[model samples]
Target: MCGIAGYIDYTGKAGDTELKKMTDALSYRGPDASGQEVFSLNNATLGLGHRRLSIIDLSPLGKQPMFTPDRSLSIIFNGEIYNYREIREELSAKGHAFISGSDTEVILHAYQQWGDECVKKFTGMFAFAIFDEEKQELFLSRDRAGVKPLYYYQHNGCFLFASELKAFFTYPGFEKAIDPQAFRLYVQYTFVPAPYTIFKHTWKLEPGCSMRVDLKSGNIAQQRYWDVLDYYGQPKQKIGDAEAKEALRQRLIKACEYRMVSDVPVGMFLSGGYDSSLVTALLQSGRSEKIKTFTIGFTDAKYNEAQHAAKVAAHLGTDHHELYCSFDDAKAIIPELPECYDEPFADSSAIPTMLVSRFARKQVTVALSADGGDELFAGYERHAALLGIAAKKDKIPAALRPLAATVLRNTPKTVLNKIFSGNTSADNLAKYLDFLQGKTDLADMIDFANQTAAPDTLAGLFTQAASPGVLFRKNEIRKLPGRLDQLLAFDYLSYLPGDILTKVDRATMHISLEGREPLLDHSLIEWIATLPDEMKYRNGVSKYLLRQIVHDYLPREIMERPKMGFSIPLVNWFRSDLRPLFDEHLSEKSLAAHGLLDHKQVAKLLHEYYSGDNYRFTLLWTLLMFQLWYKKWMQ
Candidate 1:
């Protein structure tokens, strides 16, 4: 629950002044305290800076740049190691003495005892940097589920790492060149995928990864310390449904309780969906203290779930808070999106996410968010629909599939739209055709499911081809025994981290709140990955097992409902309230100045969107977001 910034400056230039500036950029992430330390090396200078929110240890003793007993290893941490007490006991038995009741101390000592292997023994959300004084190297690790963010820039013998990309803006002589490949992917995926930032030479450390940078040789080596594939690759567990349900219940209970490890008051972001309801039910079942629950309701009824959440809160008898946000509340947050994310992010739901975080921050410092449930347990409707699509694709004769796709492809857009009731776009049709023609892969299907634009549309819009950053990692996915497993695996790697986790981390940290993903406790997902696919999605029910467990605590009517995701009315707003922003950001002057997008193509899209085309809202928002970010950070 903090912000950390550090660098190995081989040129011996940057020191306390630069480090302080870097840390200052993230001051909101840790408003409670701040610290900066610089160490002179053989021919370089290494510095570590921290902004602390004081979640676990509220005392000054928990201040970071914390060191081991011998001071051989210094560390700056950005998340909670939920199992710190257990690890502390283990370390104490191994003759380690701790001076503070902070997970930061436990991490430093753990690294001292286990070297790079320390990440394997921990269970929590974390992105940390440990400066090994003796080795003259920096060891960096991100949590397995990617709940916390860690970004780094490396080139020309200097290595810079931080908890957020904003910190890099303060470093001396740091280049701000954009990566065109990443931009095209951003246009295609609506968020830059990991290992690739919006900037050249900068990258988000992949989840389940640890990197070591050697000061003397300036050699950087990164290794995957953990991966979902390890679990997905295993044979499906043959356990019965009864045993599986009980096992899952026990795991869910443990995961939710573990996230309650905090000195500060904690709450739940209860959306009243299956995921959040289950977390609330499990955590509030035995607790004497009522858990504070927060929900953001839209004034628009179609998007509002506050009433459902209120029912759950009433049923559970927990303290609940709800805010009904108008268009003004959401629209006011748009101008700040570029700064909040610090990247060209296009998740419009971020507005409400930020609102909830701000509302909850008044009463709690730590809030448990149920984010990984969909990816881990087949909760999304698309998961079931895509499996259906695959089944239908399998049933159609492979030879006739190509003919069918050809006939559909040859049809005029207007006729196709008429046939599909104006709900299908050319991009959607292209992807569906690819699937029928056997040209679509798992990643492409995922892109179709989550895309803001179609492949053909993006190709026409961008000057460069989108890079298949992580989407092309199909060898392992192809080996999965079921389409559902493949879809889940690809999502865990791409969408979960690239969009979902990124959205939560940035939105929460922007408001200085520690958002914990209890459902994403790596162990829970690992176990879920082992169970048969049917256990998760069966008989047209998504999250079958999860629904069963939730039903035990909540009545069927209260918990079973269509998943209304955290969303804004972008369709109407883009035409009315947000039209000015779209015009301002996508003006000809702005597009011509950037020279990365086709002005004519953008104009065509804009014209269609303004002329009663609501489906283009996703792509339009993507463009507007990129333009906003480009003007802020690049220009």
Candidate 2:
């Protein structure tokens, strides 16, 4: 894993010092080594820079800006091709020669042989840039699932790209004002989605897509190269229970085995959950050498999974490490949030992710995580409960629907809170939607300065749900399983990428440790997508099939335990240790100084929450994150 940044100066006047500054901003991502390459072609310069973390081949031969044997194509890559060895053998048999035993070399050779179609054969997470020297064209692509990020800025015939938004800021002519549409979406979704960033001129490349920029004409074209729907639409086949179990076992083992092909020592992040435990078990089962496992614990038992992780590690006979996080630790990291996330991000779990990655980096160079399990296998409690409530709502008489909604609307907040008990359901859909509105309604959220281009986040969500062609399989699948599958699929498409992956990437890269996700392997995801919903969630249980598969290698006691997420005691912290900071940062004066939020509304929320009239901790934290981010990046 590494960081890549570069520019194609169509104006033909940019200097190497500019490229150096861009690469220098990403130093935290690749502390092992750095390199830059420049080529002058057709009165323009193509500058490429790379920061290497040195995972696969820890030698100078593996340094990037790697070129084909003829040096016709040059490339800089930022992710691992887990199946590169297999691809390398096939290419070698087909008469391709390689100079190094590195996945970067495989990509360079594969691109030379297959052109843009080479992306179809790749089976790992990657975001890369390849320059076709003869054609004077730049080809940029992101992985199928967007496990990594790539941001680019195009202005005045100059195209600059980087692994992080911070790199773009290093350019002398780059602008820094926040994009209003992006800020509105950040308030609503808690993170800016693809094709939009906090900066007006910058955009994120969508997953499964590639972009090509022509130097002479300054024309940019982007096209989707892969679709998850193609795999989902295949005819279903039934396998016996034994056969299914064995197939799952083989796929997981292969996934783990492939990720273990690193030069440095590797470890697993064991959260004591079924997903992480399964990964730990499989890695132990296949290897003779001891594997290291890491976990973070909180003093509050409700938030602590270290004991469980320790138990699993002991059972698996691995070298285990645990770190106890206190309020001080959380406080120490809060000020560094803006540096970790280049844009305004509000996921609090980022704290634990960073702490764990910091702990893991001390013991291992590479670490594996089980991040995509929940989204792929229906592992969230919300999915099952939403389905059940929607089913019950469907059965209610049409004449009673309005009456029921009226009653729910008139019901006292206290009574409704008691009845639903914090579960977001159709019965309380209006309130939940209100909560998600985040400070303002859709119409009011748009900036007056750019009324012609009012932000349409809700429209974007519907467009995503109703996307045309093969990608619409998610919309079709939603029709089959009540509205819950739609919610889950939306989470898979949006939250999994926007929040979870962002949290992991920043945390792991900040410590210069490469983190890989075996469960997120695209093949396994495609296979799970084809399975019947019943196999995923049976009898109100989430991830039923996954639990059964895990039981094969772990005790029932460990498999049956309740899920404990990597969470902090935000409620307690707000009420105690973080109270002063929260008040100071979210005060009316602070909100007014920011000028993006309405001070009156902010004061109302603070008063209501502190006076025990409302539970608005989540909203407050979102505001706090935005405030801090603005202070760090904009001001």
Candidate 3:
């Protein structure tokens, strides 16, 4: 893992001094060594900078901003190419000579052998930019799932790209104005989705995509090399339950083994969830020595899973470590979230994620994570909810459906919360019907399920001039066959990369530790995509096949339980220990100075939450994060 930053200056202002500042901004991502190269290409000059973490070849030969033997192409890359050794052999047979035992060399040769299509052959997380000296062109590509981050800004005939958004602030003529639509999106979704950053001048490069910039014309064009939708739409392959499960077991083992190939010591974050437990089991089984496992515990038992993680680690006979964080530990993290996420990210779980990363970095340089398992195998309860809504919503009489909706809407949320008791299935009739109210189709169901704030409610919080943060557009993804399949694809497209993957990338990168996701192997994702939703989820059970594989290693009693997702005690924390923090960052005075939100409306939400409107905790968190981010960046 490394950090990469570069720019294309048509007027020739980019130089080594400017590149050094931009690269050093990402030192937290890589602290071992740094390099920069600036080249004049006719009318334009190109600059590339890299901060090396040295996970693969711990030698000076592995230094980046590396060049081809003939010096025609230069490259700076961030991420591990797990299949680099295999590809290196192929490139060697093709008479591609290399001076370094680094994946950077393999990528350079592959680009020479495959041209712009080189990214198609890579099978790991990556975001890289290649500067072609002869063509005076810059080519950039991000991995298939966007596990690595890349952002760029283009305006006034200048183009700049970086591993983190902060690097762009080092550019000479950069501005820090917030994008209104993106701010609205952040308010609505608690996160601004891809291709949209907090700043109007910058954009995230979409995953599985590449862009080519022509220095001569200042023209840029983008192309998608791979997409999840293409694989989701393929005809389902025929396979039986036992065969499929066994195949998945072997494939996952191989994927885990591949991710374990690093010069540095590696470990896993054993969350004790189905995904993490399996990763730990497979990893320990393949290695002779015990692997390190990390977990974070919270004071609140309902939100803590460290005890379970301890059990999993003890059973697997691995080196286990756990850190129990107090309310103060989380509070200390809030002040840093603005600069850590580099954007307004409202995921409360990021607090624990960062704590865990900081803990693991003390022992290991590379840590394997179990993300993408949910998106790949229909693990979220919402997937089952989407299916249940279709099957159960029609059972309500059409004429009485409006009456039921009215009744459910009229009932106090406190009463509804009592009845559901936090369970989210058929037994939660009041909440289910409330969610189903006015829902016409699967799209409506999805929107209702995903809403952090109602479109109407969010519209009221902003001025009329602000465009509604469009969380998703109609044509963003093609319709899939099954409701679960469509939801999974939608998440893999938007929520997976935008929220989950982004959260992990930022959290792991924050502490300068490399995070690898074994389950995100594209081949495993494609094979799992061929299975029917029934195999993935059924009878109110989520990740059905995953449970079976984990059961082979763990007791069903330990692994099977209501999924307590990684979350914080938001309502209690805000009302008690964090009340002063809320006052400091989200006070009326702060909101007024920010000028993005209506001060009165923001105050009203806070007042209501204090008045026992418990559901407002989420919205309040979002508002607080935005205000905090504004204070950090806009101030």
Which one wins on TM-score?
1
Segments of candidate 2 deviating more than 4 angstroms: 412-421, 424-485, 613-615
lDDT by residue (tens digit), candidate 1, 1-635: 99999988888779889999999999999999999999998978998999999898799999888977777888999999989999999999999988899999999889888989999999998999988888888889999989889999987667899988889998876898888898888887789988889999999999999999888788889999998988988888999999999999999999988999889899999999999999999999988899999999988889999999999999998999999999889988988999998999998899999999999999998899889889988887778667766776778898799887888888888877664443566667877788889787755686578777776677888776555645526677888877887899988988899999999998898888999988899889889999998898888888889998999999998887778989988888778767788888788888987789998898899999999877788888899999888888888
lDDT of 2 by residue, 491-570 (tens): 66666778788889988998898889998888887887766666777777888778887887889986677777788988
Give each prediction's root-mean-square deviation over alpha carbons.
2.0, 5.4, 2.6
Residue pairs clashing, model 2: none
User: Compared to the true structure, candidate 3 yields what TM-score?
Assistant: 0.95
Output the worst ten-in-a-row residue range by lDDT, candidate 3.
Answer: 422-431
Per-residue lDDT of 1-635 in model 3, one digit per residue for the tens?
Answer: 99999888876777888889999989989999999998877887789999999999999999988989889988999999999999999999989888888999899889989999889889899999998888878999999988999999998667899999899888895677788888888777778888899997899999889999998888899998987777777788788778888999999998999899999989899899999999999888856799999999987999999999999998889999999998878888988998888889999899999999999999999999999889888888777756766775668777788787777666776765564344332223433665567544565556555657666567778863665533444244436776776787778877888888889888988888999999999988888888877678878778888888999988877887667798778788788878887777777688778577787887888898888777677888998888887778777
Clashing pairs in 1: none
Q: Give the number of the best model, judged by lDDT.
A: 1
Q: Each candidate's TM vs. the true structure?
A: 0.97, 0.91, 0.95
Task: Quote the lDDT for 179 in model 3.
Answer: 85
Residue 579 in candidate 1, Cα distance off native in Å:
1.2
Q: Model 1 lDDT vs. the true structure?
A: 0.88
Question: For model 3, what is the alpha-carbon lDDT of residue 37?
Answer: 93
What order do candidates take by lDDT, descending?
1, 3, 2
TM-score of 1: 0.97
